[model samples]
Each structure stands twice: as C-alpha cells, then as structure tokens.
Target: MQIEMKNIHKRFGANNVLTGVDFELLPGEVHALMGENGAGKSTLMNILTGLHQHDEGVIKINGEERSFSSPKQAEEGGIAFIHQELNIWPDMTVLENLFIGRERRNAFGLLKTKEMKELAREQFEKLSVLIPLEKEAGLCSVGQQQMIEIAKALMTNAEVIIMDEPTAALTEREISTLFEVIRSLSKQGVSIVYISHRMEEIFTICDRITVMRDGKTVDTKRIKETNFNEVVRKMVGRELEDRFPARNPSPGETVLEVRDFTRKGAFENISFSVKEGEIVGISGLMGAGRTEVMRAIFGLDSIDRGELYIHDQKTVIHTPNEAVRKGIGFITEDRKDEGLILDFSIRENIALPSVKSFAPKGLIDEKNEQQFVDMLIKRLTIKTESAETSAKNLSGGNQQKVVLAKWIGIGPKVLILDEPTRGVDVGAKREIYSLMNELTDRGMAIIMVSSELPEVLGMSDRILVFHEGKISGELTKEEATQEKIMTFAAGGQ
Candidate 1:
C-alpha cells in the first residue's frame, strides 16, 4: 500500500497555496510531514483525504490512479486522517464515537451494541488506551479523548493513517503509550503519515521525513540522514537561534495569591502566588489540574474553599466579567473553542473584550476601535490585510495572536496564559516569549500553564509542579530542572 502525489498543484483564485507538491509514503513506514503554519500541510492533507479537490494532480494508490469525490470515497479507498482539530463528537460515548459512521445492524435493522462495544474495547486495549467507554466523551481527560479518536480511525482498518499533531496535549507517559501503538500499527503493515510540530517526536518515531515550505516540497530524506536544526531550517527557510526567550527580572512582592483553594475533583488544595514582574510556570502530567487552578483564579471555575487576594486585599471574583473588571485576563488553551470566533474579523475578535470600555453609552466608537486594534496588530506583528480580514483566514500562529491581543487590549493587571503557543510556529513562539518579557516589565503578574517542559523552565521565574489535583513541589528559577520536576511530578501522582 503505497500512496503517491504526483506534481500536485492547487490554487484559489490568486492564491496558489500548493505548487507542484509531490510526495510518497511506503507501506509499513512512518513518514513525517514537517512545515511551518500556512505552509500547505493541511491543504495537501485535505486533498488527499477528499475534503478538497486538487486543481491539478494525479494520486496513485496501490499502483492504481484514483480520484476521491468525498471523504467517504477516500475511506472506501482505504485512507483516513486524524486532523489537528479533533473531529470527535463530545456528547457521544467512546464506543458510539468509534462506530458512528459504520454502525453494524441486524437484518431487522437493530444496531449491534454489544458487538461494537466489545470491538471498541479490544481496539483501545490493543493501543494501551485506558478510557471509560460508557462515560460521556467530553468528561474524559484530553489525553484519553485523543486515544478515543485514534480508535475511531482504526475502526476502518485503514492501511494509511494520517495523524496531525497527535501528542500536543499528551504527557510523557501518554506519548510513550501512543508510540507503542504506532509501532504496533507499523508491524501490522499500516503506512503512517505523521504530521507534528514537535521535533522530538519526529526524531523518535519517523523513519523518513518530507519537509514543505511556502507551499512546495523542499526535501525528503531518511530520518538518520538529517538533523533537527536542518529540518527546522528547511521548514521555515531560516535558522532558529532560540525557541524560548529569557526572563531576567526577579519576582517582586506577591501580586495575586490563592491560599488553600479547593475546587473539588476538577482541582484541589492549590496554594500559589504570582509576584509582580514574574512568570509562575505550572507543569504537570495531563489532567493533573494545572489548568484548573488557573481557571479557578480567573473566575472561570468557582472555588468552594480558601481565599483569593489581590495585592494583599481579599477579593471574591464570582464570574469572568468580574475577573475582567477586577483587572485579570485569561487566555484559554482551546483557542478555536473559547478564545476567538472564527467567522468574525480580526478587529472584532481583538476588540471583543474591551468593546464596552470604548463604547460610550452603547454606541461603539469605530474611530477609537480602529485606532486601538490597529496598534495591537502592528505591535504584535500580526500578519493580515487590514484589520477586517476574517480570523479564519489567518494562520494558526496569527490566530493565537488574536487571542492574546483580545486580552492585552484590556491591559489587565494579572495575565494568565494557557498553552499560549500550542500550534504556533517557531518564529511566532519566539515573538510570544519576547512579548511576555515586555508585559512582565510593565508590572503584570503572569501565570502560564504549559505542557512543554523546556518552555516551563525557560520562561518562569518560579515553577510549580502539579501532580494529581495538588501542588507537588515549588522551585525558584535557580532550582527548577527537568529531572527534578519530572521525578516529583511522576511520584507525586
């Protein structure tokens, strides 16, 4: 089962997104597709998966030329893709989600419930995925939900599996389990098209690599023949000196304090504080309640016990609106789900938080609005056509900037950023790190929840390790190290 794209050419009016892109995947081999954001990775996958039509190209699968009019057709032809944005339904159970499109039914038209659940459970067990099949999919941890999505892909017995950024939210242990599954898939002769932003995963698993840049194929070579720096350069057209910027200023007096905060099962007994001009980095295993603590402080989740104080003054924030009014801002991890409205323009998305402040008696000040958003766009180096371009048109990194700009426009005293650079490119991540330094210099106390351990150590003045719904350890800048945090976190759990 070999898949080949011969001289693919796709365009939209004046924008030639993909130009003569060519690649091939051999059976039983894991191949990684590496590229920066808006570099035609998603577009090419869409064409291969039948979501988009190629203007000009020929696809050959198993030595036969074929065309896919729809995703169903592609599935019938033995192609399946797990997109970067998850395609699972939150309301459905694990078994239901797996057998959704291909539900088995009897002659009398009754669905085979027991058979499906048994099959689903077998697949999960084979993949070393632990998930409660009867529970609602939304209630599961993000790592567990990702495994369920993988099980759905396997339901098709797909010969060629395309996974995009599969481990973005997974912890070290979960990723190890997923790699085991990938090895099993390869042993079963399943060809894998793995797309990842993390360089570490590619080096660990991929047998070969295809690098894309500016909508064209740059190079394809054996994994051992190239290095990480070389791969990154091929993807972005330049060398990246640093991934995380330096945080210099020492933490001042405590600006925001949470004393013995408890939020039931979501998170509990979290006591921490962020000082002025300091970044307090939170690290943990997946579902270890790092984000929950941040959410509780921002009033997204209510606390049942303990006290929150701002600058030594006790304050109770009941809602997000109150948190905002009290000069606090939160950047959610799921940007598309919670941070920005995709259909709206960049200006509207950026102005959403502060529109009331600038609006005089229910009348929006367009001039003032334009002036404010335009400055942010320029300052953040947001790439867009005016401020009126739809947020959907921007790249992933730019969309993240829109979310940051939304909160930054309000000039909040305490800024909390969750997975701030999840899908951003290398250059964008550096820019974001620089922006964090600027904000801290202006006396903002920042609490950042991040999955990338290097980022936590690189940007934080102090580090807090969350194991399982509790604080496991706290370290100042000098004492925080990868070995220390990992040992504490794994044991604390």
Candidate 2:
C-alpha cells in the first residue's frame, strides 16, 4: 500500500504549521521527515493519524482518497502512529493495555484475560520487543517503553507505522535493536514513517528523506543523494559560521575540581577539573549520572560525600542560590518544567534568574531589565516575534534558547548544559552550537552533558565518559572516538 498526502495545509489561529506540504510513503520503504522545530512534521503525522483535521489536503491510500475523522478510522485504514510521547496506560499491565480497546469477549460474553496475555506475548515476540507482559508500564526504561509502544502499533498489523523521535531516549544497544526491527518490518512489507533529529540514524535507516522548513516543503531526495552538510544547510537556510571555536583557557590555577565524586546506585568515583575558559563534556548513557553530577554541583541534590573546590576555594553548596553566587549555572533537560515559566514573557523569564542585578536603589530598573534580556536574545538568535511573546508559544528550539538566555544572563563562570539539544530541531541546533562556541571563546568555563555522541565528539574539547554516575575515563578531543566513548560508557570500568 502507498500513502500519499498532497497539498497538506493546516493552520492554528494566525500561524500556519503546515503549508502546501506534499509527502508520500511507499510500501516497504522507510520515509523520513526532517525539519526544524515547529516545521510541522508532527502536525502532518497527526493529520494522517486523524488526531487533527487538515484545512486542505488529499490523502490517498493505494491511490484512493480517504477521510479519517478519528484514530479508529485511521487504524482501520492500516495506519498507526507512535508519537514521541508514548500514549499508554502506565498503571495497566501490558496485556490489558494491548487489548484495552479491542478486548476479546468470552463465548458467554465475559472478559477474556487469558487470550489477551497470549496475544500480547505473541505481539512482543513478533516485533522483537522485550517488555514484561505482566509488569506495570511505568516501571520500564524510556527505551523499553518506546519499544512497547512500537509493539502495540505492530499488534494492529499496521501497513504504515509512523514513529516520531523513536530513539531520543534509547541506548546504543537499544537503538541497534530498533534499527534491526525497522529493517525487518520493511522487509515484511510495512511502510515506515521515521521522524528523528539524529542524522546518523537517518542515514543508517531511511531510504527516502524529505526536508521541511517553516511549514513548507523543501524537497524529497534519495538517501544517497543527500549529505549531512546539505541537509543542515536546508534545515537552517544558512551556513553556520563556526561550531567549535578555539579553546584558550586562561589557566589561573584550578577554577573547579571534583575529588572522587560518587552517587551510589547511580554513579561513583567521579574526579575531574575544569580551568577557566574550558569546556568539558560528559558522554554516556541517559542514566550515567552526568545530569546528577551537575545537580550535585549546583546543590540541587544531596551528595553522600564529595569535595568541591571553586576558584581554589573549598565550598559547600547546598542550594542553587549558593551555586549561582559561586558563579555556576545549570540548564536543565526539561526546559518546560525546570527552566522557564511558560506563561511569562521572554523578558520576564530572563530576568527571573538575576533580576536583582538590574535593581537600582532597591527598585528594579525597567530599562536595565529590558537591556539585559535584549542582549541575550540577540546573542542567542532566539526566533521570536517580540520579547513580549509568551515562552510557551515559541517553538521547542526557541524555548530552549530562552532557557539558555535565562541562565546566560546571570554571567556564570562555570556553566553546565544537560541535553541542551534534546528535543530541538536541526536549525536551532546549529544556532546553539554557534552560541556555545562564541560563549566559550569569550572565557566561560563550561560543562556539557549530552546523550548524542556526535555532539559530544564535535563540540567538546575534552570528553569524560560516565558509567553509572562515575567517570569511567576521560578523553581529549583528539582521543574521543565514538567507539572508545561507547566502550567506556557501557561499563568500561
């Protein structure tokens, strides 16, 4: 079966999320959608899945126009979508979740629990997904839960399966397993819609690729015809000036030093140091305690015992405010929950961290506040109509930039960024890379935590591999090979 969407147009209020976007998914082919955040990839998928109605479009399944008013209609048409945020009942067992809506009834008209369990196990095996059949869905790793969601799509025998950012939280081994499963599905004549930000995975799995920008179709091309640089150019519509700038550390003794930092059960024995104007990247699995170490550094979490020295001065940081005063800044993974107040305007959010800095005679200086916010936004290239716009209305990438702007406004010497580009699109990623290089060049000691291997490899001056919250080994940029990083990250100790 072939799925074709022609002239897809969708709008919300004054913003057109998808405009005249045309796409297609051939039978047994993995078609990938590439775009910046807010480019409407998810919107188009939603329309195909009948979760949202399109203003104008012709959807053809096997050359016949089809209309879907709800997910049931789409499912009946052999289309299944697994969103980035999995839609599953965490409290329910896997068997119950698999047969919730399509329950088997007994001959006497009662529930058929035995049949559901048998069917769920069959589905898991068929999809090569490892999930406890009777366990609660909430008690699963991010990758396992993702696999379960994909398995559910398979249980329906979907002709077209759409996956959005399927490997965002998956480990390297899990990603390999998923890629194999996708290939098997393609071999078995299932068309796949793969949406992801990782370019390496795109090249590894996708046969055809389509790039979208600003809700408009860029072009669709064969995988062999496109390159990473070309795809990045199309994503941002401009060349990035520089990604990693020269690292010239002032080296005024040791600015910060960690001695045998340990977080039991999560990670242990982490020891490292960062001088002024140095950027250190921690590379590892999603739970490698890189973020946890940063949390402990910023005094967000309690550490059993660890020595922290800032500017050659021993310090005990038990609160974020103390960390802030000690010239340390932390950017969280979930920008919405920990970074910014979505309801507030960008100006207000940036001022929230160090609003007192702009105070004159104990009264907040409105002019200075605006000046501080404006400087960060301009430097960060935050895409917004105005600073007055609510941060919630911005794109995911832009929202991340706002978070950066909020923290950068404080002028911290030791800045920590955790998964800074997690849910961001390619274009904004380029911009973030640009800002990081520029900021580091201007003498800001930095610590970056990233799950993406390429990013850590490309941007870090030195790479520290973490295994269960401990530093397995440290590698300089010249020595930080992806394979080496992976080895140390996967229990190299």
The best candidate in terms of lDDT = 1
lDDT of each: 0.87, 0.84
Report the Cα lDDT for candidate 1: 0.87
Give the least accurate 10-residue stretch of model 1, judged by summed lDDT.
242-251
Candidate 1, 423-464: lDDT as tens digits: 776667778999999999998989999998888998998899
**Candidate 1 similarity to native, TM-score:** 0.96
Q: Assess candidate 2 and give its TM-score to the true structure.
A: 0.88
lDDT, residue 315, candidate 2: 90
Off by over 4 Å in 2: 71-73, 85-141, 239-252, 343-345, 358-368
Residues 1-493, model 2: lDDT tens digits: 7988999999888877888999989999999899888888888988988989999989988999986899888998899888775677879887777776888998898988787778888877765667778889776656677778877788888999999988877777778878888999999999999998888889999999999998988999999999888887887787745444444444444678988777677657778998766778888886778878888989998888779998778899999999999999999875766888999999999899888888857899998898888898898888777899999878767888999998888888888998888777876777787777777767788898888987998788888998877778889888879889989998864
RMSD of 1: 1.7
